[model samples]
Target: MKTNRGGGDEALKFSSFFFMPERPRDYLVLFIRFSVIACLVVSVSLVLRATFLSSSPRDYSTTYGLRFTTVPQKSIALSPTGSIGPLNVSHILFCIAGAAETWIDRSQYTSLWWRNSTTRGFVWLDKPVNLPQNHSDVRFSIPIRVSDPGWTRFKFSSSRAAVRIARIIWDSYRLNLPDVRWFVMGDDDTVFFTENLVKVLSKYDHEQMWYIGGNSESVEQDVMHAYDMAFGGGGFAISHPLAARLANAMDGCLQRYFYFYGSDQRIAACVSEIGVPFTEERGFHQLDIKGDPYVYLSAHPLTPLVSLHHLVYLDPMFPNKNPIESLQNLMKPYSLDQNRILQQINCHEGKRQWSISISWGYSIQIYSYFLTAKELTTPLQTFKTWRSSSDGPFVFNTRSLPPDPCQRPVTYFMDGAEDVRFYGTKTRYSVADKNFGLCENNTEHSELTKVKRILVTSMKMDPEYWNKAPRRQCCEVMEGGRGKRKENEMLIRIRKCKSSERI
Candidate 1:
């Protein structure tokens, strides 16, 4: 019993020491240590969350819906040590020309628009002259010489200014500039989105002799140049190999076409002899308007802007009053949305009643002015463009005709038992000829609202339905068929009920 009691005492002594209360200083130290460890753990967790999980910068494309992109544009996979971004454009030599008086304005434009460029700018003057401060280096005086053909016909003459200019400029930089890949030509007043231009050139192999340019603006100009000439003021690019060939032949070739009028035509004629064709690109603006016209640049032209010509006379191209600021504004929305920018819509349920505007990838938004879908009795201007100072180049013009879908350029129509059919085309508006003026014609609603314009025949109706019921064939109508033309075609049309007869 005494030995058992001794063991119990030893146990009690061990328990008493283990359960003793800590002092205030010791307890405070323990709490501080716990708080420090907790703070460290939380700080580390927050740092890890921020580093591993965060949204990236906004994509430059003005996409309004699901941006289904395959990979980053202008991005190249690089080795661990290399950097990647927009392509470098050192291989291109920019050769620009202008008359003596406009050098100052052109130089200012060149500095801003083609800033930080790997370019050699040349301004060809009409006579020997002293240039402004920074302009002396790139400017060259007239009587610009090239190898003469040594004959009167082929020789550069006073009357044929274009021939002389082309021979001198095109030949001057041949083989001498060995390292360059392309020679891009433009007037000093021409403004270029240099980055987009670089990207456009990168797509093609510079080794292949390439001649790329844009077409003339109007039908009259087309008739004059016969659409063969590249509008020179708009700017054009020549690959190294072609430039070499042109340098060799242009002097002799210019002697042949004494009748040619402008520099562009003469250059076009020379190239025609050389057999390198003009690859047309859309971004080049060749003409100046009578007044300030912002629609050409701002209204979503299908191509990326390469250059704009004749900016001096026209109204400013951008929101700002300054021309340099206007030039920079050309890069907005990086790329044009080609697919379904304007959908070919039939006058079905939603389309006819309200206005449906489908902008690029963004979903369709329907705007309805009336409470109920009814015929617009009053003559409402279907399209009108308001030129408010605030609204820049983008006015929703339901008034502008769907600029495409030109059928056979003729006018003829035939009527079937149930519907009227237009064989080819006449005036833009689709209408059944009545004793008086014409009203909304078929499903096409041709000139009605510029929104969704399509002919009745294009609605994917069954061929048999047209043939057997009130029916006849179309494309074949003009060709030949057993069914004679429907003389009474305009008489019968099964149209929807009109709202009111009082008007």
Candidate 2:
């Protein structure tokens, strides 16, 4: 064995290279040192694994595949599909600003949109009212909750109600209703298109601070109440986090802004202190104007129509109908296609030199002569400023009616809309008023004059369309794909524009 120990001798030499401890206890010492090293390695591995997990953010995606990153505790905006889900009407808590005196008249307006079970929140009245025992009989969809009497203590130069109204935000936040994401405040007369509102809000993260609303249509009003202020009548939305922060600072904020003229102004001032800026959404119409809203509505912005306020001060939405009745008619088509309601589309037939503009679910304008896409989209100045009744500055561009009525487009108001099942929908528009004069019996005008009704066919717009950048839909006159005359009727189809197509 000693004679043939070639590899064995090398192994022994390698083992003895570290001066061998001669005691048996030395082996135990060596084993303890290796064990300690093993334990430290295992401990380090576990610490690393935990640190990676704790520092890494959880990812959340929306129905549209929008991704948001958040940490463990403050992952507020993440959909609870596993924890929360996409924003729905139930997540929105509407805090309606109302008064006991106006409740009788304004309750009618609230009943129009408010759903008893489907919608959440209450009509916060200045004082408790003698509400009917059987709420269903009265057709009121929202229950009344009297605002805390504590609002009267705030100092204010404006109507004392402004102070109370401003507190609606704090009041709604303090309720601590579970699962609420947004607090929407509006006047009793404000009509909200809740479906479209949900669509708009779905784009924003509810956990983050958002002060969303619209400025007054009248420059005078905006100048008086900071152009950025979200007029309460037009309605505004505050995200859950922002509302909570607002609640904490609100009482002191109210005292500071007591001299403000409007409840909305006071709110804007407080929100400014929190370092949140006003986010103006075109869809929320303060409607700070007097007279017919027809012109303004006819040329709505290329966005979802969210809310309308001051209906009591203006003429009804349609001719030959009162305000409520007109609203009832409008809601008919709105129920059918909410996103398409008041959406404007223009098409021209070259053969007849005819230009047609369609306000889906609202009105139609037809002209024998040609008008550029830009001109047709601009609303006519048929309305005056809210305060002065002057016909000057508006937030958007407006074209004055021609002194000659002949230059104006023949207008048609929506009559009805019907769903076409598997296909789409058909909206009918008929002449409402014969107020505008026709051009002196020209042959081109003759052909247009004979047409009495317009039938619009369109697919129900997906609510997700609002989540992206807005583009006006393109339209084509049916039959010849140009304006073809029918016996007192015209048919048109609306659809998304081709990639290479122009409006």
Candidate 3:
């Protein structure tokens, strides 16, 4: 009875307050305040819901029974205080896989292109090696970093080195280097044409995930491995964001893919788990061949020459020189015009009834007889497969050398190159002193043999040329070519073809 009276009193007070009439102005103000409060509560609830949904993990399942769990995108930590304007030699970090045993011989290949203070990265070695007292040479440009020891703990099939090498991507990312957009991995013997490499990499957005490189040239090797796998010796680039993701997952991935034969395959497998596919840039030459690389290097694809590998297995690029010497000779012209190195251009000298093929910065061939464009472009079958020395099944087409020596063209190797004015270059090619039977009865053959040296003039190829759809530049025999010049000399010019000009 006492509790009922107290409850009744409270109810009566609430009812009186609810029913009490107020001024019209006061009522309007009350309604407005109520509405505003309601709106604020609803707005706050909506904002909290949106934030939670965005930050939380979500599952997207398809009708086909496949499910994908996606998390929020994480922002990458860039060490550069200022904005990275454009990709350059410094923007790339090279993580070279090296061993103490072979470093002495193979280190020369790395030195060939590695710039002392400009290029970034380290030669990751199994163990440290003694250095020469005179370490001032460009050959010692790259500093060495010995890998952490626990790489042997991972289960491996063929070689334990695969585990250590595959972990390079992980170890390199852990360094937390500054302003590194791309991490380029390669074998110690791999030689990179860095200028051309920078040109190719600039085309891609480094902020996004990119795994760019080339596959094996041999179909057998591709079949033995994976067609989509980037051959490591050719060198491959992993963008910053992708490298971070790979590094986080590399230890677990290495444990899972331990049975893979090669380190490249292990890397490919880990990359696949991250859902980034292998992107092929044809300029990366794995050089998966036996015998000679002359014909292959001569007829380069319509792209920038980025890298070359497996030089130790193949014959020297130029005759009468060792492998390193040949590369040094090639590098001289490469330094002059890297974009135009080994770029092919063929033209017909209609008056002399001759066909001329130019592998710029490398070699040139002059034919007394006329040959079709297809015949000139196709690489001669001068190489075999990597694993098996078989003739069939290369990635690209090849043509056999003509059985008749008479049909063969006289060959010339690059002697020297000099800048001609500001915009152009003049590369000289001296006839190689090799004995071959000439087309004896033909007048064109006799006249061509007397021509000893050929001078090629062309505008310096802009590095920006590779950014567009590649079209081979057309060439023409200069006017008064054989008439006004010395009997032992020839001149030619390479230029862009006009809209109506046909090859």
In candidate 3, position 46 carries an lDDT of 100
* Per-residue C-alpha lDDT of model 3 across residues 332-410, encoded as one tens digit per residue: 8888888999999988998877988899999998888898888888887788999998995899999887777667788
What's the lDDT for residue 454 in model 1? Answer: 15
lDDT of 1 by residue, 221-240 (tens): 56656576678878888776
Model 2: per-residue Cα lDDT over 1-503, one tens digit each? 87559779888766654446578887887687678979999999999999999898655333333333332332223232222678899889999999888897898888889887788988888887776677655445467788888898989885899999898887776666667788999989999999999988888888789999999899998887889788999999999778877877788998898888888888999999999999988999999999888978988989899999899899888889899998999999999999989999988876787888888898998888989899989988888999999996988899988877677778899998999999889999996664666578567777777888888999998767887788999898876334544657888889889999875
Best by lDDT: 3
Q: Candidate 1: where are CA atoms >4 Å away? A: 1-87, 132-161, 168-172, 319-322, 328-503
**Residue 211: error of model 1 in Å?**
1.3
Clashing pairs in 1: 154-255, 383-399, 415-489
User: Which RMSD does model 3 reach against the true structure?
Assistant: 8.7
Which order, best to worst by lDDT? 3, 2, 1
- What CA root-mean-square deviation does each model show from the true structure? 21.1, 8.5, 8.7
What do the candidate models score in CA lDDT, each in turn? 0.45, 0.84, 0.85
